[model samples]
Target: MAGHHSIDYTSITAPYKELCMKGKGLGHLKNARGLSIEPVTGMIYVVEGGNTRIQVFSPEGSHQFILHPKFAKWGRVDLWGICINDGIVYVSDYQGGRIFLYTLDGDIITVFAKGFTTNKKMIIKMQQPMGIAINQKGDIYVCEFGANCILILENDSNNHIQTFHYQSPLSIVLRKDGSFIGSKGNLIYGKKTSAIESNQMIYEGIWATLCWFGDFDSNGNIFMSDMKGHQILIYETSSGRPTLLHIIKMTFVGSPMGIAVDRNGRIICVTDSKLHFFKGNTKAISMYS
Candidate 1:
């Protein structure tokens, strides 16, 4: 891939066929902030702040259960970032600067990696630690909106291993290698050291905000949701050019925040109001095609 890539909005896919809007009394959700799919159970988890709750759904889009409706009592109002591993769910408290661990059944088990500080020796305040991805090795990569860095936490010891700093990092997706893809104003790819010096604008004429979320597809394509632009962008792994694959009208509850791909290569997105899942039949077609 080049140091910098450009985006061509005309060539990508748009408005996937399988669209489902579900609102089963979620009760005053401030914003559907973060989402993650459990690979083992094939269940989707969603989180919101004002309501201070987590909702789970089966792979088929059935309501499985809800967790932590009383999270406010735990002294946290701004809850963000959700990730599931081996039936255990991990959530980040943006206000508290701590990570809450819970059982799949909604039981608070333990907390880890609380109160992170940077090399400046100042207490690194995380305004919104939104993005989270767990690799097969059980390492957790956490992206903080405030610090603009991705923190690597060892799952077992809960020790801080390393931090990858970028220019206002909104989300991060860890690849099989130590390298990662991060979204700030544009999608970026590099190792930790090179990532710091690597500042490339992948998308132009679009306002990049917290709406950026990404997950890798079977064919190594990277799919992302651009919230401010109201579009879903895809970038080929080999060639970094972005293709504006899809555009959807924004709803009060639909901000296109989080995205993930299932085993079947289906695309699932979490907006402010609803969870949007799109399954394309074509086998990784190029956007220009």
Candidate 2:
């Protein structure tokens, strides 16, 4: 998948078709809050707000596998954000106050608990990790909800590098150019991945909408979920201002939590163990894919 310079990312003239409403894989999803898409194969990985195992689905939204993590370790699991890098799966535990890494086959890798360090050797404890994003360099940027800031950890996630103050951001989507989309309250906006003073705002949310998890397609178009408003907002940021591409509002958007876009430009929205797939105006490539 290469650059999609020809297709316009600003509007969806056609309606989105439901791809996975009455599917077989979403039966166990109780408040499915977090989701990720594998870059190479386009498999979808999802986690629930309730204590439950991770779920894997095929590109076509077929039930593939149920990964069994150490469920007994945490009395109550409140997973908020999930991400996929290469073949490794990373999940953030909101209630547990840490993050977990696992292999594709469900093998335990390592866990990130409190007591993490900073570049200056200062100990900083992560509180209520909500959204987790791994860059190409392997750096982990987490939304520390309880602390009300965005924490940037090293690629290995052993320590911290910087912390940007945010107003209770629920999710974030990082771009390859060192910029990211951040959320606060009912709005999702973009900012440069720099220090607080140097951070540049890239046109805050165009509308009054809530975002759970957001992603960028290969063409640099962004996809975000508006759970409360029951809609999905797509935008293109190349112009001077953020251009509204489309709004996908569905009646079944029962608290749409996570929004993921695959390589084929298929948008996946999750709500209460259910996954809905839809093809956009242009089925171009995604950056991760």
Candidate 3:
């Protein structure tokens, strides 16, 4: 919140009449990608990747429960990136390479990691993890996208450590210099967060077209999504890098991408079926009062 911060965007209001949620069954939202907000019960944990399910809402949007995380040895769940530490709820399973851990009223609390091992250390596959980041010292950051690279499930251990290889080519996560990083595969024995500095910068160019995830906001800013440039890029690492600050053009009809930010900085996103609210640039009450 210092040096270069501007976002009035005309008091930025949108569907946010106290938050909104739209279309298609039980708590709604279809084709959605990811969302996370539970900083002590502002609830709202959506991620309906085409209805594979996980809805729970309440930062005013009401309806609080709609999960569908399957078991029988893992058989259904195609979600894609969501994070809410401490109360535990880090979901990612693009076709199930795994990364689940729920309990903010959803249950299940295991399988927090999956396949990865090559570079002559072969034997482990089934990884297509798409966008999942958590760094308040929990260190998760996955985007494996079938090993095109960025996996680190440290501390909450499941094996797989330190990996940052990127042909990235597109999506899940990426953004250089300022910090917020993602994939083609190669990493295991996980657990790393303050250790990627050999001149550290290698996720150059291409921030979105379909990036689909990234929601950090306790101050490090960063609330990504550009699904074909519909827009929503607001980075700000407070001078440690990542500067852009604001751009929320939104016109969406489908293809917006998941993004969440609340601890009062509200801005819950998701599209391809609705749920777009934005009420956080306050200061508008002099209209003749």
Q: Who wins the TM-score comparison?
A: 2
What tens digits encode model 3's per-residue C-alpha lDDT throughout 1-289? Answer: 2233334433553545433346667776777777777878787777877767788878877777787666547776688778777888888787768888878877887876546564447544547777776666676767776776666557466666566656542233322223554312221111123445563452244344555555656555666666767777766656655566677777546666677767667777867666677865644444445
Q: Ten-residue segment with the worst summed lDDT in candidate 1?
A: 1-10
Q: Indicate the residue-level lDDT of 239 in model 1.
A: 57
Candidate 2, residues 120-228: lDDT per residue as tens digits?
5666678799999988788898998888888887757466777777888789889888888878778777887754566678768566466777888877888888877
lDDT by candidate, in order shown: 0.66, 0.76, 0.63
For model 1, residues 1-289, the per-residue Cα lDDT tens digits are 2242233333335434333344446433346777788888788887866467887788877777778645655675677778788777888888766777788888887776465555555555445676777877778878877777777778877766666666667777766654566777654444532344454334333334434677776555677777876766665656544444445344444557778877776778877766676655543334554
**Clashing pairs counted in every model:** 3, 2, 18
Judge candidate 3 at residue 165 and give its lDDT: 59
RMSD of every candidate to native, in Å, equals 6.3, 4.4, 15.3
Q: Score every model by TM-score.
A: 0.76, 0.86, 0.35
Better of 1 and 2 by TM-score: 2
Inter-residue clash pairs, candidate 1: 13-245, 253-272, 253-273
lDDT of 1: 0.66
In model 1, where do residues sit more than 4 Å from their true spots?
A: 1-30, 116-127, 186-189, 192-211, 240-253, 283-289
